[model samples]
Target chain A: MWLIKHIPPMAKALICFTFVLVITSVLIWLLNPVIIPVLVSLALYVCLLPLHDWLTNLGWRRDMSAMAILFLMMFVVLVPGSLILAEFNEQAMLWQSKASIAGQSLNELLGLLSEKLAQWQFHIEVDQLKANILAGLVKDNGSFLSSISSLVMSISSSLLLVPFITFFLLRDFESLRNKSLNSLPNKYFELGWLMYFKVAKQTQGYVRAVLIQQSILAVVAASGFWLAGFDSPVILGLIAGVLGLIPYVGPALGLLPPFYLVLANPEVGFDAMYTAVLVIGVAYLVDNLLVIPLVVARFANLHPLVALLSIIVFGNFFGILGMIAAIPLLAISNIVFYQLLLSFSPKKFTTNVASFH
Target chain B: MAGSPFWQNLFRPDHKQKKHVRDLWLATPIFSGVSANQCQQLVNDMAIRRYENTEAVFKLGDVGIGTGLIISGSVRICMGEKVLAQLEEGDFFGEVALVIEAPRTATAIAAGDTQIVFFLRPQLESLLSRSPRQGAKIMQNLAKVMANRLGSTNTLLEQSHVAD
Candidate 1:
């Protein structure tokens, strides 16, 4: 351990980074089941930082301000969340009925395609194909329901834990950070603060951008769905908004629900599907052209390949929550790595260039 | 900065010592006229570190982000081989860094095992946003300290010129 002191500054940074990464990974692995709640609390902590600062500026003590913010958040979320859940429940029941008819129609369409293929000497077996498809669907549905139930259980547990964690984080995060930095050797202490502030600022901005991006996508998509005359515009909009957080494939996935609903009324199905597609297409175009460029691009300028790879890897390990968090987490990591790398550059040791002094 | 558990427990700063350190901060020109309660609040945001004897607190040309107040023992401020000043208990160095993150003009090393409290630029910025009145008072005091130092330096220059 004393040998660490003799290493070059760049090496020290690398060692520190590796140690931190390993510790974090191990902690996350150990806390795998509760990771979601912890992550949610952290996200809430970051998102509410500005409001926390504003309240403290108004002469409120940190604990009181944090408490008030938590209360405000609960009120803001619960009221709308309950309303949305009710609407979603009603729409979901309707969708379930429509889905059965849609499934039958899709099977018939597939059968027709198989018949046409048989005429071309493809030797298609429509009956066998249909049976296999039904079996697979049943199996998938069974797994999906189990997964959903487990997800609900975790979320219910998290609902109790998130506030308690966020409260402590809100009140004591700075001191906690300082205490952690206190363990650093004297030589790296200032550098530690520099990195801490830089990372915190970047992460905060990225989280804020994500919140705004998600809201815009949800509002725009829901409005579009409503315009398309869908019975469950809000639910569809919510799904689309969340899915749209994913990069390239998300917008396509967002199309599935409306298409399913359209299938129930086969005569006018194509017309409604076309309208829905156009509406969503315009929304996606606006997001890519306007919102993403202005809000998210400034912080999360990750390569498409990197984003996709990260999403797949994280999804495999952590499921849907991981997929949603992949981009932001990746961006934060990139910022930390970049800052650590910057510490190695000789240019940084130069005299301050600020005109203020 | 980790000490053996035995040594850590042995040298652990007590409430009395901490209060004494706060009192020392209150006496400093940069914190002059600040209320003790306000000083306590500001001090809560600062950091303290212990340096071994002959250890460099910071080296020349190192980026300085904050001022350091010696809480115990002594510090030797030097440039190259020349001794610039020997700062004792309650003395502060690198105060300019609190205003701007300039390179430290001189290196500071501990004369003995020394404990120093740091009031960094980031904390100052946080204070400014969170409690502007307290922040402004400290900044005002900091300006006055700089002005007095500049006046003394100017007088010293004038005296040398007249002697020549």
Candidate 2:
């Protein structure tokens, strides 16, 4: 105990840092099944903190306020969400019925493309090419269908878990925070609280800003798609909104789905494809020009390279969700790292003057 | 604490404990003028920590966060080998840190098993934003405490000068 107390504060800090990191890693591993839902709940809690605070200030009990806010969240999110899902389901069934004709048209289109390329001295076998493409798509489709069942299961579980986690978090998070912080040695107690508050404040701001910006972008993109007469406009807009959160490549990735749909359906004109391109371009323009400036003011301070690396790394590990979460997570990590590093410096104090000022 | 019904207790396990602490805080210098409801709002996020005998609550040169009220036992404020003040229950120290991010000027060590309730800056800021009236009363009381301490120190310096 004496030796521990005598250790340099920085050394103690480093030990504590490593201890927290290890505990977090182990907890993440242990809670893997419910991790996504927990994260979603936490993000929702952050977004709704102001509302909850307002309710509590109105003399509402914490439990009752949390319950009311949870219901509000469910109504706001689920109503629109269910409508979009229903529209998407109808569109998906229609597309499924048209798959045979679409496949025939796609083959014909590819054959014509091969001939055009051959005219430019880029000779290729259309039959072999079609076979390979069909094989790859079939493989992907099989895997996609297999994954859907698991996705459904995960969603079902999250439906039950998100509200439960969010409710408890809203009601008792402060008490939980205080209890955990009390375990810190008195020396680091202040540091812990400072770090916790700094991290929480920054994270809450960034998450709320991002959610707001994305929702607006989704609306803009969906509106543009509807104006351009695209199928599954809501779904496409949602994807574009999510993808737009990524830095450089998001807009291009957002273009792929509508373009692919255009190619699969021969009856859809090239004019619709052109309109899709123009609409996406304008949608992203609004996002960069209006939404970001108005909602977020400044983007995360990460270098383009860092943002790209995070997107690639997270995308590789966790796929689309990881890609979507990467920048925010990186931004948060930046804030945490900055705060922790700043804490290590000795606090500055002014000297006492002889005369009262 | 155990007398509450199961649901209420489940939702707020520390309800009784918090009420007891709030009553104690009402007597502290910083909360002297604050009403019960105001005190409850102000102390909503205060944490009670227990320290064993002879343990250092904080040391000189450490960054101070906010004030701590001695809920039980006693704490001795010291600078090096000097015995500055012996504070018992209901006394509070480190109030200056609530207004400024400064290193502690002295160390405080527990005389025995001591329980202290901390009102940190974040909670104070939160209170200020949520209910300015309560926040202003506490801040006013804090200023008075600091002023009283400064007046005493000035008097002591003048007495020493005369003796010299």
Candidate 3:
């Protein structure tokens, strides 16, 4: 009671805010499963704004532009994505079929191996282990297929959510921002405005640069693959190009499907792998060196590690939506937190803020 | 720069005939991507206007209805006797006239013999509609201008405190 009487209002507010953060973190951790999809939708919104702009500039109205973007997302992202899934499943099934077809052949080899092992006095039962593993896989096939079907259904639903959220975000962003800004408490109003606007500029610059660079990479990769006579060359280029947006992990994730496709084919897989790998490596290098450095980082300047951390921390606290929202969240928070410190802090802090803003 | 090839004559451009095409091409930012020949060709679609030294190009109360760019020499933006800003070669003027069709806000005078390439609002509008990139570039420049103005105002406020 004595402490409550003495504690200042601002200090009390800060304490209250801290408590809110803790509670929010708890809530987000619980709700992450649903929140992650919304986060994915928001990422699509940020990444796709420039495409919408380009189409609108070309004389398509906003609604038409939104429709065009949705269509492109379906064909470029969803269709190819679904095809890759079906294709991978087909290859996996072939491998599964071969496991059975090659089962008799495998038993014979295992018998020869066990004989050689027994000859060497190494009592390892190679034939028995192979038979046991095959039996387990056969028993689990029903559960495995059911799970795969569920995964496919959820992905298709998420794909549909992206365009729905994206169209609204793109259309109503300015009004939403204005309304939110007006809602800030009077004491913090100016700081909030400056922080939000600065963050908006950085986000806009990043989204703009990435969209432009990714589109260029997609066309170039698609064209090169097309020239190389790879089946679904456009598909390869698109997968590689869009995945390049994910920072370090994106490029690695993009490489897998193509590798599978290569391994499946008899004559073309190796060449396709080599070409796809080269294109992706070069595209990755260009994106890191030229596109990101010259364009996004000049304004944003948050390194890949920092960006990744922001995603993880924010995602953990805010759910996956927080992860997707992390970059912009960090941008605005840096501004607001610093600005608050500035009013009473040293002059040097203000200078850094000036240059950054 | 557009009509008068050798601006070496620091006194003034002798021809003083505004090259419409040159000014139009230079007035835009996105046109930076256009080929040199194409820029020249665009200038041919424009009209030129001349301003005399120390004469008012447009005043705070004057009626004005065109958009243009400085082709040669410069203009001083003034409020009464105090010079508020400078517009040098390649600097644009009368932009607000295109944007809002508003009356002049301040007096613009030729600091020296000035020639400008201009297009009536309708012609300028038509040209911009055909080239959205160029138009967006112009809008970007306009944002830059407004930002610079905001910076100057902050500096002025600081200077006022220093004088006190």
Each candidate's interface RMSD (Å, one decimal) is 5.4, 6.6, 19.8
lDDT of 1 by residue, A52-113 (tens): 99998777999999999878867776566656766665665565556567667667767778
Candidates ranked by DockQ: 1, 2, 3
Badly placed stretches (over 4 Å) of model 3 are: A1-164, A266-272, A303-337, A343-357, B1-164
In model 2, the fraction of reference contacts reproduced equals 0.18
The DockQ of each candidate is 0.30, 0.22, 0.02
The DockQ-derived docking category for candidate 1 is acceptable
Tell me the docking grade of candidate 3. Answer: incorrect
lDDT of 2 by residue, A132-178 (tens): 65443322453322222233345445765777788889999888988
TM-score of each: 0.79, 0.78, 0.45
Alpha-carbon local distance difference test for all models: 0.74, 0.72, 0.57
Per model, the share of native interface contacts recovered reads 0.32, 0.18, 0.00
TM-score on B-chain, cand. 2: 0.87
TM-score of 3: 0.45
Residue A96 displacement (Å), model 1:
6.5
| lDDT (tens digit, per residue) of candidate 1 on B24-139 | 99999888887898788778767778888898888776667789999989999886698878999999988888887566777799998888989888888887877788889999
After best superposition, candidate 3 residue A255: deviation in angstroms? Answer: 2.3
